[model samples]
Target: MTLADPAQITPLAKAPAQAAPGAKQRDVRLDFFRGIAMFIILFAHTPGNFFTSWIPARWGFSDATEIFVFCSGMASAIAFGRAYDTAGWRLGTARVSFRVWQVYWAHIGLFFAVATLLAAIDMTGAYDKVYIGTLNLWKFFVDPGPQLVGLLTLTYVPNYFDILPMYMVVLAMMPLIMALSRVHLGLVAVFIVGVWVFAQRRLLAEFGLADLHLGLPAEPWSDRKWFFNPFGWQLIFFSGFAFMRGWLPKPPVTPMLIGLALALVLINVPLSNIGVREFGFDWARDWRIANTIWITKSDFGLLRYVHFLALAYLCWVAAGDKGVRLLATGTGLLARIWQQALAIILKVGQQSLAVFIVSMFTARVSGFVMDNIGRDTWTVVGVNLAGMCVLVLTAYCAGWYKSQPWRKKVAQ
Candidate 1:
């Protein structure tokens, strides 16, 4: 049955007064996909795990990063967009600002937490591994003053802490983008693309500003650049936002379109495979790197964008109403199992911010384990599964906290 229709029958009763239409109901599809992406991201981030080789990035240009960020933008649009629509621009701006602050502080907290953990490990001197390589802990010890200042200013982000800073930048710009989109969506699109093009050309780096140096004794503290440039990545984010907002036209699903998308996927499958190149197709590797599209992850290259869009399109076509129905109200044994699985995933997705923060810590710990201990197949699998369970538990706790009686009473 579709969303509009109920599969189960109910007793008829006197009609009640219709409630006024308000904001759109939450879309579980987004949450479900995002939750899956979270799992993929956790697996992908676990350093030295053989599983990383099997993540989507190995077979395609876009990976969990693209999905996570794009979904974040879509979720942001749902939240901030509704705020802008119901309240005034000022309220929406305030909301965005609040989120930016939260993300900024979260990034800082995560940075310190990871650094302290790695520093503790380093002090033991039992691992015989470089902590600086993983956590950038050396700078924190040598130049705490400047490093702290830079961290506060978002000028010096460690490796894993980079994404949140980029997210903060995007959130900061949401108010302006929302305003422009209201006036002219095409204008907003043009501006997003323009910034992306500028980033891809490395204009900021060309001007010697990409690595903004702070006056610090340590090399890491002195020079910094975001791994994922917000300027270029914003295009992907806004594309998701625009699509969610119905500001962009959807392509009609047709045989030709499906064929083209399939062809794109097939092409990328080989191109992304290093083994294919090692086994006598060395020219394919050279051509892909030197290709016009560039396919670089740092700048969110055109091919990456196209690859994500294509994958999304194919998923949409393949799933359609049946998928929605299954998630909504399917009841066979397998369907029931899937529904239960989706519930766990949905919880994780709903508490995504909390889950993401916890996942990063888990990833670091997992990395340490892999680096210091065994990395055999079973060990890797066990660690990954345990980490995922921790993430899911984090989500459950977050959800439970949100649903506390006192919290509800206070809100009421």
Candidate 2:
């Protein structure tokens, strides 16, 4: 059931890609939000970046993870949905399978490259700290045999390396959801919801019940699970997916709805992790500790899901129709500057997968640089700005490669 009146609750609006009369139009909103998330993720991952304290997570229950997963779902709808519609389910399945393979290698490559970098840094004896130890990868180096096998099988997932694995699992669920739509859209909804419910085993167990026993093992020996549990995270992922696929209805932007969403966001500020720790609110801390399960990141707890939706709704409304408000139209210098800035953001979002891989590696290096130097006010700003520049270059280079200038016809 919808929260709004039936009249106001209609299928979600499609972005106006307008390649042809009936073709899907590109949604600037998705790219804008995803671009913003890329910057936030960079800040959040950087070891001593005080900028992270100002990121969304510090003031709210949800963070860049929500934007990433949710946007991935919407992007998948655009990137993969057409193949399923034009080709049969079998071909669509093949297409998605290829993507999963690509992502699998990317994840593996990221781990090895980063690990090797950290190891090399440690071998130099330049810094006092063991670089590799920061990531808690000692077990992998100590017992490579078992850990290698587990890594290949996705059983040795470390917290820092869990996002992609979780993303892969969520991506794997798309074809099944698509096929379910053929039988009945309602069936697809039920199946998606059922999986999410199963993922909430942890939350359910907290209420004096049996555990749900879901999620992949995060270690070779222990019973630890992946930090980002795809099963539970898929709830939000599929929420964005379904919204793009017209499986769910978008509520009309009403003043009452906006107020409700805004209030929820405000309420979360005082209840957030930073709020409790920084403000020294004993009562808030007590409340948060007792109800930690509700906001737990691993399980994609109910409060986070609710809070994210509220935040997302506010963002959606603020961005305006088709996010046209984000475009700078005037011919003035300021408009030109804003337009260029917007282009960079959109490019970064379009190349999110590549930018993400680079960001992950660069964030570590940025921290290491600061470690060698210092994390002073100016130093912190300088290091983060340097990292952002790398990300920007990565986005531009990725975009250029994707364009394949080599394939262009020779000019006379």
* Candidate 2 stretches greater than 4 Å from native: 1-23, 207-211, 410-412
Query: Over the stretch 1-412, how does candidate 1's per-residue lDDT look in tens digits?
Result: 0000011111223212221111133456667777888888788777887888878888888888888888777677666666666667899788778777777778888887888787888888887687765655666688789778877887776667777877777778788898897688778978888778777644445576655421112134354457677877888888777766667656788999999998888788777854353355677778775763458776678899999888878876775642575365566898788878888987777777788888888898999887766898898889999999998999898777766769778889
- Against the true structure, candidate 2 reaches a TM-score of 0.92
lDDT of each: 0.72, 0.81
TM-score of each model, in listed order: 0.86, 0.92
Q: For candidate 1, what is the TM-score?
A: 0.86
For model 2 the local lDDT of residue 363 reads 91
Best by lDDT: 2
**lDDT value, residue 356 of candidate 1:** 83
Candidate 2 structure quality by residue, lDDT tens digits, 1-412: 0000111112235433411222144678888899889998999999988998889998888999999988887777666665676666898788778888988988999999899999999899877899999999999888899989998999999888898899889889988898888788889878877877777765668674446557788996788889898988988888887777666777799999999999999999888877787988788888878987788888788899999999999999998877878974999999999999999888788788888888899999998999988999999999998988898899899878866677784541
Stretches of model 1 off by over 4 angstroms after superposition: 1-23, 202-224, 274-280, 321-332, 408-412
Q: RMSD to the native, candidate 1?
A: 6.5
Candidate 1 residue 135 Cα shift, in angstroms, is 3.3
